[model samples]
Structure formats: structure tokens, C-alpha cells
Target: MKASTISLIIHGVDVDVVYKKVKYLRIGVYPPLGQVRVSAPTRFGHEQVRLAVIERLPWILRQREHFQTVERQSRREMVSGESHVVFGAAHRLQVIEQPGRERVEADADHLLLFVQAGSTPEHRLALLERWLREQLRQAVIALIAVWEQRLQVTVPQWTIRQMKTRWGSCNPQTRRISFNSELARKPPHCLEYIVVHEMAHYFHDGHGDGFTGFMDSHLPDWRSQRRELNKR
Candidate 1:
């Protein structure tokens, strides 16, 4: 079969799907695994595709479960006295109402949540969250610059925001990357891992063998950093 032709069994029936531009198609089944693709084309058959994708239905189900686990793990309500990660270190938020200051500050060990004396708790929380996001954005930009030099890749644009399940995603076509701003709270290495991971996508658009090889060749400790990041 041509590389563009994809075949699989679904609902006790075998189906073949083809892509007009795809030059290769490969599938595999492994533990804790699902569909890991490296497609050169963006278009594919829809109806027959359903049947083709069903061969990995078990893996897809496992991936969904893992996604849910990560989603639950990433939830953190910004609250006073709650412990939060900062640069991979744990710190407690200390709410303080001052006479004049309306900004939040992070000291060596604690996040000093300051607000106007008459400000409501909700307002204080909002201010703190916004401040944290700004801090994360700055850190992400700095990190991206450092990695762009280290990896010899250029990213045209990127954004930092709180993501529900993914640490980051890369749009090869646009040469843009989006990272979970929550990473600012994680360890510095975690941030580096994400930046490098996205940079790799610039060369290999998908998470395939080539992607893994690139990561291994560039950062041998990537797996460790990834594991640590997930733990947080």
C-alpha cells in the first residue's frame, strides 16, 4: 500500500483511508500508547478515517484517562494561605491589606498579596493572579530567547497562559508557540523543557521518532525534566 493509504479495523470491519498529500503513514500499538503521528499533510478522509482510527481505540481511551488525570492535577485555586509552586519551589500566599499598595509581590519565600485597605478579597485575588501571569510571561519570554539560541531555532510568536491540560503546543505553520503560564510556578528546568520541546517542533512538526531523537540529541535530561514537571 502507498504511504498515504491508512488501513485499520473498526467495528469488526477493515477500512482504508487515503490522504492526498501524505507521503507516509505508520501505526503502532504499545503500552500506555495511542496514535503518534507525523503527517506531512493536513487533509485526510473523514468517514473512512473513523474506521481507520478505531484500531487504536484502546490507546485512545487510555490517553483520555491520562488527560483527565493531568487536568485534575493542574487545578489550583488562587487563595490566601494556599501553597503554590514558584520556580519549582513551594511558597504560601500571605494576604496583607496595606494602606496604599495595590500590587502583589513575591519575596524569597512567600507571595505577599497586598491590596488597598478597603479592597475586597476577590479584587485582591484578581490582582495577585494578574501579577503572577505577568511574571510568568516575562520568564517564558526570557527562557524562549535563551533556548532559541541554544537550539538554533527561531519562533516568530508565542503566548503564555494557563492551560487546562497541555504544558505547551506549537503551530508549525505559523511558527508560533503557546505555553501554559502555570509553568512559571514550576521549576526552571520544567520551563526549559517546554521551550525546547516546542522548538523541536519547528523542525519536526509532530511527536514521532524524529521528534524524540531530536530531543534526546539536544537535551539528554529532557525526560527527567518532563517527569518532574508532570509531578507538579
Candidate 2:
């Protein structure tokens, strides 16, 4: 069954509630404007959802405030025993001292970060970002190739960026797609979804009926992928 959505204003906050066949209620505060969304089971009505929103109003406002406070940044410290996500897996960071070369290697359950002695946080962060970019690049290239043949379309170009508001974007005129470098931190399948989502824009620009239809035909569970991408 198709989901139905309704809008509600709770304690001066606008919330979009979607009723679906899920077993529980989930509320998320999204970025760019801290938009709040709630997924309630089909059995729940406006009052139930509204009460849930009311209970979480304080948390919702705090999330909104957090988004307002920080646009985007790679805030991880270059230290050992820290948590870092690479390709959707939680890897323990193991910092090792080396000279002249800063590199990162992902093992079974740990990320081996080799850096020069006394390397600053910024230095190590830059090194890690570079590594993530390369990883994202390789994955996106393969995804683009697969989707290109599957969709029977050609992409002019694609690049990775540290985007603050979007996972991916496409220019229909240029046939160029830009993926967020942050995709490296998410699941591999999320990267595939972004590639397909951007490439689909070649046929449909805005997310209207045509765009939704195209996405549904190609990636039937795109909505779930999108939800996972936006999980808080």
C-alpha cells in the first residue's frame, strides 16, 4: 500500500507525518532546515502521532538547534580508540606513528592510521578525508558504469564533493552528477542509490510524478534507501 502523509504543527515546529505499514513510530529531524518527519503505523491516527510529537518536542528542537549550529565538518579527532565509519561499517581507529607518510588501512575491525609523529588533528583529518575521497571515487565509478548500462543512458561526467545539503545532485543540461564525499561513511548500497538517483535526473528533473515513477521503476526500494541515508 502507498503511504499517506499529513502535516502538523507541534509547539511551533512543523512536522510531516507519514502513515505506513511499519510496526513502530520513528521520528527524524533532517538537515538544511531541520525538517521534522514522523513515520507512524497505519493503525495510529493524528492524536497518537501528535502525542508522540509532543513527547519528543524537546529533542526535535535540540536536533534543529544542532543542525543550525553546525553546517558540516569532519569533526573526528586524529586520535587512537576513536570510532569512524568507512563504507557503513564501524571500525576502531588504531593510530600508528610513522614518518613522512600519512596513510590509512582498513583491516577486519580496525582502521590502521599511519601518520608522522606529532601529527596535528587537522593533518590527520585531511589525510583521512583524502582516503575517503578515493574510496568514494572508486565506488562511484563502478556504480555509474553499472547504472549507465542498466538504464541505457550515458553520463557526461561525475565528481565527488563535501556537500552540506545533499547526498547527490545532477544537472540535466550538463548530464553531470556530483556525489557527496560523505557517502564513503555510509553503506555501499547507499552510494549506489545516490548514483542511480542522480542519473535518473537525466530523464526527470524535479521530484514530481515522472521523477518518482522513474525512480520506482529502476530502484523500487529507493524510498527505504533514502530513509537510511537520512537516518539520524
Q: Candidate 1, which ten residues in sequence have the lowest lDDT sum?
A: 29-38
- Candidate that would win on lDDT: 2
Top model by TM-score, which number?
2
lDDT of 2: 0.83
Cα error, candidate 2, residue 223 (Å): 0.8
lDDT of 1 by residue, 1-232 (tens): 2224344556643333434455444333211112233232335555535644565667655664675665566555555678866787778888776677577778777988767666675676578668878888888888888888887777889988666546788887998899886676778888889889988989885565677789999989999987787662
Task: State the local distance difference test value for candidate 1.
Answer: 0.68
TM-score of 2: 0.73
Clashes, model 1: 1
Q: After superposition, how far is residue 202 of candidate 2 from its true place, in Å?
A: 0.4
For model 1 the local lDDT of residue 184 reads: 67
Where does candidate 1 clash, by residue pair? 88-186
